[model samples]
Target: MKSISFPFLYLCTLTAASSVASGNHGLYDVRPFTISLSDGVPRMLERIRDTELPDAISQYPGNEAGISLETLKAFRNQWLVDFDWFKEEESLNRYHHFTAKIENLDVHFIHEKSNEPDAIPLILYHGWPGSFLEFIPLIKKLTQKAKTSTGKHVSFDVIVPSLPGFAFSSAPGANWTVDDSARVFNTLMTKVLGYKAYAVHGTDWGTGVAWGQFDGFNTSARAAHFAMLPFLPLTPEQLEAQNITLNAPLEQFEEQRYVDWSATGSGYFIEEGSKPNDIGLVLYDNPMGQLVWIGEKYIEWSDPKAGTSPSVLTHNEILRIISLYYLTKSILTSGYIYFQNPLGQTGFRYNYTRARTDAPMLFSAFKYNVHYWPRALAETVGNLVLYRNHDFGGHFPGLDNPPALIEDIREIGSYWE
Candidate 1:
């Protein structure tokens, strides 16, 4: 990977006033959003499955390059015969869905209010190849007041947004980066939701947005939790240079993952970041391409047995995610994120100064995730009030380990109370 110069743009701002803010134009209504796909899509998708997919599979039999033929076939059969988009839509509507105009785009989000006294208002952000759907499993748990082992009452009024250019949300401008995304999301929580201050939690690309809030709107973003640690870990040389001593065992377990991910797992990032349009255009009309592209992540990044037999996430769960991108015709725009913010071999290369804050922050380090760090390493990024290690979950913890994730979040909510 060649070093590409990043022309940094500073869009970071810090403001948390309670006064209602209208964009250049008046604020649009936060109206209910319905997840209805066009009627023709189901039949059309079925036709493609029955015809095009088999031919592609036959031609690329040893496509061990990506999702195996058997897995693709299973998804196709289930999508055609068993998967029910109507039922999934109904289940999605069980929560409050709404869209409001933010920065000249319709920003879609799930805003579930809790009646529990002093419930924390939190905005949970999801990363790429993930929708607001990732947080659905934990929604009901967080929205209702529950007692912790210590007998403390905790609940949250949760807001989960589809990142701009993904799923139901409108796409940002062609030049948008995570920083741009950060600003828009800050406006959403403070001005649209009418919350003076709130907590934030995120994983993957959502972590960038959460970091944005903490960096730009510290007054409004009171606390944060991250399933994906954003900043890179300190190298042994850096530790020695800074004369910092380690208190905990140097986690060679995490070090090995870094080596493996860098060597074999970075192709998608390069293609998406460098030439998003190249692949996005090719896959624009190819639903199978979209599924193969995104589905591969679910298979590789998630726990190996998660969607397999005794599936933690069933075939239906897998199909629902892919189906949304296909139905909405937004897969291209979502994939374009890589093009806008190109990551190099080292990792994310952003030009803005690292946003440091004293606000309480928590980090959940799951073993199977691509990146892991010790509590001491995580502390350098923020207030680092809590760091918990988990043995079983992988990158997609919302699905792989929702119960554990929810419990950790409930524990964090106690700080707000």
Candidate 2:
């Protein structure tokens, strides 16, 4: 009986060891596989044509107004038919794009090589509501300027990849967060592209990934640049002590707008992070729902002048982002990322003003969004090399106001030398 008992225990222990080993061994090279996107489109379109999102109300005084009839009209006329995917596709493909396998997912990215040899390589990361298209205009001018006398692109060789579940990149597995996303991007940069050291730039959620990369990637990502800095953990007392006034206006007009954004604009964030799948299902089922969700951001966040802001999305930009998702069918996976790193949502909740990046961070703060002014906030992040209060450009500056956006990239891009 004692001999039989000992054998049974030994077998149990062996089984446990085998299971742990199987799960833990993915640290080796992560080669991704390509998944095509033909079947998913019809399924998504059928839902769009047939479905109607329940008219949900905002949690405020003008609740009914926020869910306005005009918003619906914009969705029908602009997003449904006017937006042309082929136009944006042709434009986006003009840049040098390449795809590679990273951590069990096929990753698609735009790699714009600079004409200059000493060009400092840069990687751009965009948050939700935008894709690699976010960085297109800036990249074009950087490569075009022939900036240096030697035509040596000085500071960066730009590499912009779609976040997992965002575009061509694979969606998150059961366990992927800002940390995982950062690590994969770093891998894309250092392991696959072979850059020993490089600078990273990002906006919105991408900012968090960029910061995480600074800590995770051993070889590169030592330098990080992000626009929306997280200062969540800090208390009100600490903020005042640091001379950071949350409600004070930097401009003389004196009305604080960020507080308004926190009250209203941040609802999507809570929805996505708290109930990602619910909203994702809506986005997945109704193409109109996806447009309402994403299209509004482009309208509210982009520059109003070109009359091209999300307020009135042209058929071009809106379809491009939606097509990327539809062609990929990554909606649920994209939303699931919220839960994977709940901490990532609070990433800006900390009190630290700046994490101190290694490279020169160009912060072209949007003129309208008062969340954080470019000049004051730059001190909290990196080597505040260039601070431009963009007269034009809202959230999607590169796309909203391309020519001005291009000029800024050309001017500061030469600094890599």
Candidate 3:
């Protein structure tokens, strides 16, 4: 085996954080080492079929957004039959792809740079119930906008990586957490992609990973930003140690997260965080199950208070995300990631006393979710270069409101430049 010197290894470590953060994005001059997906995806599907669902219908807690006879038939007819993985695969494969062996597991990512080489690099992370597919439309906007906004003289290099046990990547071999996933992403940027500086934006689970990556990462990853910073109701322990109280103004952000956690998260949390393999086996097998499970996020993540009768996350976008997970057969492995994940540091940052990063953050949230009212909390955190609140959208804004999402990205890209 070849050996790397101290200085060289250190350089790679530092550059990793600043580089474009996904697979097959043309960040590396050398081709990404390929990994196997054929055997894994099919096996997952078979397992999903073998597992059985209860005779009684299962629906969301409290509000039963029951699938009507008509809707059920439609889902079974179209999603079960006509949903085409081949076409989606072809569309996704148009971008450069890369794979590399990291910690004895295969990692998959999309790494694409525009015509301009020095363009600022942006890494987009996907949360649970979604895959790299969520960023497809945004990738088009960011890459194209960077050029036009910059007079075609420069552009943005985009990296979108599937987290460990997601899509083409292998599940954790032993105990893992969001932080471990963050470490792998950091390694991809430095060791494989040869980048020393960059920025990251994540939603859902990706946001957790991004938080941890920036928390302890000993590199120049610039700054980390997220949509959901769910810290509600100062825990008893936090009170004991810090003597902090959740006053009227302080409780707004934390209270809502706790309310949602109690109301909607009971089932999803128990299954994914604990007995994942049981139901995950079924999701892996049945495409119908895949769609339902992945599609549930729209209802789950979208604030029920949005006033809109239906979720702002359009059906086409919802289907697109579910299709990726279903086609990849990553349902089981993705769930396994949650199982292996434990709170190395409680997963709850709870660091209100300390400023996270000096880098400016562009926190664009909607009034529907807790992200809406963060002005007070924003003051407690690091410098908020821009915090815009919209009356629409929810957890996944890109899917909820693509136009506004695009505008935010373009504006931030220009601001940072």
The sequence of per-residue lDDT tens digits that candidate 2 reaches over residues 32-151 is: 212345456566556656665445434532324353445655555554456544455556545555455677776777776665566666788887777777786577556543454336
Residue 342 alpha-carbon offset, candidate 1, angstroms: 3.2
Worst 10 residues of 2 by lDDT: 17-26
Question: Taking the tens digit of each residue's C-alpha lDDT, what string does model 3 give over 1-417?
Answer: 111224454345335533334433333332332223334445444543454444444455333553343444454455434544455555666665555667666677777775555666678888777677667767765766343354444346788888887877767776777777878778777666667766777777787776665555635466655566523324335444555444553344544654555565546756777888888886665666776666555655665543243334555456556656765667888886556654234444444543355665666665444332254565455556666665566667666665666666554454453
In TM-score terms, candidate 2 sits at: 0.76
Query: What lDDT would each prediction earn against the true structure?
Result: 0.72, 0.59, 0.59
What are the runs in model 1 whose C-alpha is more than 4 Å off? Answer: 1-26, 50-64, 148-151, 232-251, 307-311, 344-354
- The number of clashing residue pairs in each candidate reads 1, 25, 19
On the 0 to 100 scale, the lDDT of residue 43 in model 1 is 59
Q: TM-score, each model? A: 0.85, 0.76, 0.74
- Candidate 1 on 1-417: residue-level lDDT in tens? 011122121001102211122232135545555677757476547655655545456655764566888888877777788878888878887676667778787788887777675878888988878888888898888988887656788888888988899888888887788777878888888777667888999898788788878877889888889997555544555555756554444355555566567678768878887787888788776667777888888777766668543235666887888878777777889977777765531125323233566678888876667766666666666777777887667777888788878888876665663
Off by over 4 Å in 3: 1-70, 145-154, 230-261, 303-316, 343-346, 349-356, 369-373, 414-417
Give lDDT: candidate 2, residue 257. 43
Ranking by lDDT: 1, 3, 2
